[model samples]
Target: MLTVNKTDLVRHHVPVTMADRFAFRLVGGLSTVASVLFSKRYGNRAVVLETVAAVPAMVSATLLHLRCLRRMVDDHGWIRTLMVEAENQRAHLMSFVAIARPSGWQRFLIVLAQGAFYNSYFLLHLLSPRTAYRVAGYMSEQAIQGYTRYLEDLESGVQTDIEAPAFAIDYWHLSPQAKISEMLVSMRADEAIHRDIQHAFADALVAGKLLPDLPATDLDAGSSIGLDEKRLDAS
Candidate 1:
């Protein structure tokens, strides 16, 4: 029988996907609705443009959200529960882009533009440790919440055949807060790196860089730098 090692225990990595972009999406969606209303109220191109801007914001946020999740699935295999979720998003975007409607492309373009803005923000934050630190603080809060929820769920009468709890107890005892903090901090650092790479890809697109015909995992290899975190040092 194999024995469990406390040292090898790791906290679950929750994806900052749609939840992270909810506010942006909600605001953008509302703005889009408002734009439509204003356009109807007064036949002004300005209102149409304002409404059109929301499309990009919504698209970019949604696409970036999916991109983030796809990376998560790559890092950790598809969790069945999220399977439908991931599929639904892809489906919606595909239909939205392909739908034959006036100004559909314009709206989608707006979404694409938002993606660029968000990606730019992600890159800027990635380059600046100070900004990343701020983001880390936010991430830490979320991590702690996830950790607590996991613990509470496990504390119930039910038990798994696996010795995960025993391992967790022993491991957490050695350096509880330190481990959690480290995991959370690492999350923030990775977020910065992801943003940076995404920005590069977005720029390439802006500069007329053709989308490469790459394998499913090709992007995985290039976009994922966190795989080497243990070997890399922070200056």
Candidate 2:
């Protein structure tokens, strides 16, 4: 995994177009709702947020695959990039699940929220992929902010700095004695990459580009951490 510099942790995309404004407002509304529901319970919030976060990449990859097939053109690596992103997000969800140990009702809420978000995002992507990507980028920015606050709480002794989950340590190549604060730092780096990639995709679409290169984050080369199917299922 690439090391995340201070600049990477604080990046944000400015909204200019009407579509960009729409995405900004939409993410803001969702963030408000998340705050209302979870308050400062960042662990539980992460479980639900990561569950929903895993959806858009899979949806984009599926649609792009179909589009490539229909047009008889190569995807230029976008499919694999999106699939890796989905896998990374899934790893995040599973790690948080271990940390949070969510209740049965919370799990049910996750299911409902995931289904609702998947359908809504699928429709949005179909209608306007550029705007959809912008929404994703903005959502990731919000995730970075949330994780930063979570880290602050951990560091300030507001939230307990628990030992990192075993799966998290293995997945992120973290030290055996790592704590949840370290895991959050790693996860925040992942979110920073996601934010950049999503905005890059949106910018490419807006520019009428056929093949958009992945950002210098180098996540497309598998620099980001991921878990295999068997390992994920075991976790």
Point to the candidate with the largest lDDT: 2
What ranges in model 1 sit over 4 Å off?
1-177, 211-223, 226-235
| TM-scores of the candidates in the order shown | 0.25, 0.90
The C-alpha stretches of model 2 lying farther than 4 A from their native spots are 214-235
Candidate 1 global Cα RMSD: 17.9
lDDT of 1 by residue, 1-235 (tens): 1111222123222334443244234434544654564343211322232233223223333444565576653322212212322232233233223222336655665566456645654564345423322232232233233333334444563322223222222322323323322322232233233233333333334346422123232333322232221221222
- Single out the weakest 10-residue window by summed lDDT for candidate 1: 1-10
Q: What is the lDDT of residue 106 in candidate 1?
A: 51
**lDDT, candidate 2, 48-144, per-residue tens:** 8899999888888898899889989987677787788888889889999898888898889889999999999999999999999999999889998
The CA lDDT of each predicted structure is 0.33, 0.82
